[model samples]
Target: MKYTIFSTDLTNPLAVWQHFEGEERVYWHDTQVNRVIVAAGRVKRITEAELADYPWAWYSQSFFDTIEDPIWQNMGNELVVFTHYYVKEEGKAYWVTATDSAPVIAPMTVPSVQHTYEMVTTGDYTAWQSLFEGIQQAIRSGEVTKVVASRKVAFHSETPFQTASIIGNLVAQNEGAFIFAYGKGDAVFLGASPEVLVRKRGQDFMSYALAGTLKKDDIHDGGDRLLHDPKNLREHQIVIDRIRQTMLAMCDKVDVQATHIMELPNLYHLRTLLYGHDTKDSILTMAKALHPTPAMGGEPREAALAVLKQFEPYERGLYAAPVGWVCGNTPLFREAGDGLLIVGIRSALVHGQDLYAYAGCGVVAESDCEAEYTETATKLQTILKAL
Candidate 1:
């Protein structure tokens, strides 16, 4: 099927987002290129086999390892094309024409939302002690070399959350990350993620191995402490090695950029960019293989995942999973439409008045329980501050 695009007067996607009426909605802001795609209303619920029949679709998957939890199942894992979508990039905005005619880009005002909320964080020091010891045992017994341990914090408010406003806040504040949201019914999973799982444009492939963390204030002598610290560098190298091995196997050529400090509002992270050329695999396929990397899961991926499934207190759901969109053979074309999926870190799941926010840290042999706990708490602020 062919899809067309037309110029629109829509300037602010956040304004359009507030007025859109759709049971299923998707929003993606690519900070790397200043691109935004807001999709609303389901056009068709297609499977992996029917991808070519649609111009564009938003796809999401639960974390590779899951449990029998209804909250997650309620936020179904599937692929779908929306009836209407708005795309803006390079100062140009357009509305898409799929199976239905394009709708007028009417002016709309976003309602004022209250930002006050009450929060209750789980995983106290006692709980952290238990998890830290378990991972330490796992590492000692050769069950896994490293594990990324995650924690969840819950928030409550008298008023229901305004997702669009939260999204706007995320976009405005988190300039270094990609802002993404997927809403179905009363559940919305949204975050500003600094880790790109995969990005595909024709045969060009790009991903980032991001691990190691320190507070922005903790940096001394120009991040040299973070750069030279043994524990942080060890954690960062594990991630770099994992991605290097994966890309070497899949691509004709692979290259890694110098590791540098990535500064965010609350923290500083060690980041390295990995790029390659692959003619064999599709974007999603590559993402599936590279996901749950040492940065998010651990080294010796399966063993780390087994550890998480067995001992981690809560189910991850879409917390650190791959969530992104594919524009297959659409007017936004460059031979094959671009694909981008980001790891869902620094994110939250909004269900009405309650919010579940997630954050994690790499637990290496050198990891200190207290330090990791503090790291996760700081990470949670990415969403908390937006709220």
Candidate 2:
């Protein structure tokens, strides 16, 4: 039997299926661009018999080559398969989708709630100190400008949870922002970030390159003054310059705004908003050009990544990686091709009761070990409160 393809514009919500148990299914409102195709249920992979179960034309990322696809032709398309669960006083269940849009709502009996816990604790302070010392020594030798390092703590609990619920909570509390939660197998990532590396809203491309950091002190009278501190200015300039250079190589027309200050709950940051027009390159090409920016990774991508791989104790996976959606197969929206990627800062991975969270600070020539440590601790609070 042939199935009807149900693709919707970014503004329209489409009916999407989300699996609970291997046998149970629910409908959710998918208002975003990415299409959902079922590869498997909780009990098993999708079988020929289950084809009828999914009446809508389904798609999967198994075949598409991101690097080869054109940005405009595959607009409104996304390629990540996410498995998420939400746990709270209300109930516990899991849902998988490719976009952030809410799923189609369906009336169904709630499943039996399971009790579980996952705890994430930090590594020993001594180990952190040792890493910091090594980083400082590298700075003295002039091998790098900045290096961002992090650690994780994982604990397990019996209950299952929803990744969207956690993201919703964080985004609701912070507006004009992006919240992301993507999990594959045992690894999960959830972050509420205000900084946008790049957004394609049509033919127009916008980017906010943010760098420099300062902890907010309630007692300080001229706290905002810290945004312009020479150390902070220098840090931010490096990021702006790196982003501008990258954009120029891949974009047809690029314009950058003067640096400005943006405030978060814990601190102030320096941000430079950029506008650009996409070239003929695919989104993946543009992404490759811009990623590992000085903001998330560091200046001189290859060298910085080398330092991280050698010194960092854990693999980053998608921790500081890009997370968002892509849609629209049109030229104007080529870069925006229905895709939105937010930096995975202020994020956590929750399973059972154990929530694995991570935070990293940019360490530059003038960076103080104690100050960077404090900055990471402050960033962790975004996810820590929900747990």
Candidate 3:
């Protein structure tokens, strides 16, 4: 139950990720706070029951096991990895946390290589139409109120993709996001995500209701139109109501901040931050309770998920799942330390020369198939620009 700390340079943290080419690695960079964590090499495989002993670990879980897919299955479909080598970088200071005393590791040289690739959508308009029709039918029939629909696009390159390059590009181009890269051998799951599933700092807990989206184009009034659009408002309110109820059940006191627009490089999201105080639940517990929060899974959680399972042509895997890290020092200790889990939207999975990127949007009864499709395609640009 001991860890060693040592000084290290993290000016170019992506180089540190490249250094451990042969080992499993996990990278987490919170751009808002300017904090980065890079962990490599596995010491032990952690279970749900072992959270107390190894509270500090990287967590990545699949959206849900709706279908069997080997690509994601090989990448540890539904597993959380605990590593021996962990490094934390905040501002100008850098330090390592490990289960054993390890030597000062040097960053590897990341070669500047230009890559060429072709892109193809996994599903076509007809496929998207079918899914949209299905969801609309369900909503009209009162089987479900809203359902989030998603699709995948694949990029095929002549040469194998470099994980370090992608990570570096994501950090440089994307702002106000949690930049992440999790790699094991030839497969890597990476993205720049803006939605927080849940974040815990001691007894203070917070979750974001980020549902409505609008392109931040010159034609539109930035986020002003998104703020007043009735369809978008209804979609966003669904998320706020669900999260508020869940927080109230677990917390002694809860407060939802004023609604505002979360502006990303490509789009704007209606965001309402919720806070819960003095909770006995742990980070993992809070994350599990709030994941796929209408923002991803849709309204009446279970019913929407069922609709997705029946209509979504591709497996979501970790696309919109809860992915993050947890920290603590003792058992049954809800008061221990801090942790944050973010919804894995705007993400991609890399296998050798093939990279599959995913994006989704909420579809209420009033949603139009063509409009939703365009929105999702625009959202995919977050990862495409990085590539």
- The top-ranked prediction according to TM-score is 1
Give all TM-scores, in the order shown. Answer: 0.94, 0.70, 0.92
Better of 1 and 3 by lDDT: 1
Residue-level lDDT of model 1, residues 19-45, one tens digit each, is: 564468888998878999888877776
Cα displacement (Å) at residue 158, model 3? 0.7
Q: What would the C-alpha RMSD of candidate 3 be, to one decimal place?
A: 2.7
Clashing pairs in model 3, backbone N/Cα/C closer than 3 A: none
Write model 3 residue lDDT over 304-336, tens digit each, in one string: 999998988888888899888776554422434
Regions more than 4 Å wrong, model 2: 1-104, 107-122, 155-165, 201-203, 219-223, 330-338
Better model by TM-score: candidate 2 vs candidate 3:
3
Candidate 2 has a TM-score of 0.70
lDDT of 2: 0.54
Ranking by lDDT: 1, 3, 2
Clashes found in each candidate (C-alpha, N, C closer than 3 A) = 0, 41, 0
Instruction: Give the alpha-carbon lDDT of every model.
Output: 0.83, 0.54, 0.81
lDDT tens digits by residue: candidate 2, 1-387: 221232322221111222332321211211232222222223223332332332221112211123232211322223422232121111222233333533444543333233355453555456677777777677778777776666655545555555445544554454444555444343345666767766665555677888877777766633468665888788788888888887788778889997877776666778889877855554445565677678877766667777776676655555666655443332212322434555667766555356677787787888877777888888777776544
Model 2: how far residue 315 lies from native, Å: 0.9
Off by over 4 Å in 1: 47-49, 65-67, 74-76, 121-123, 218-222
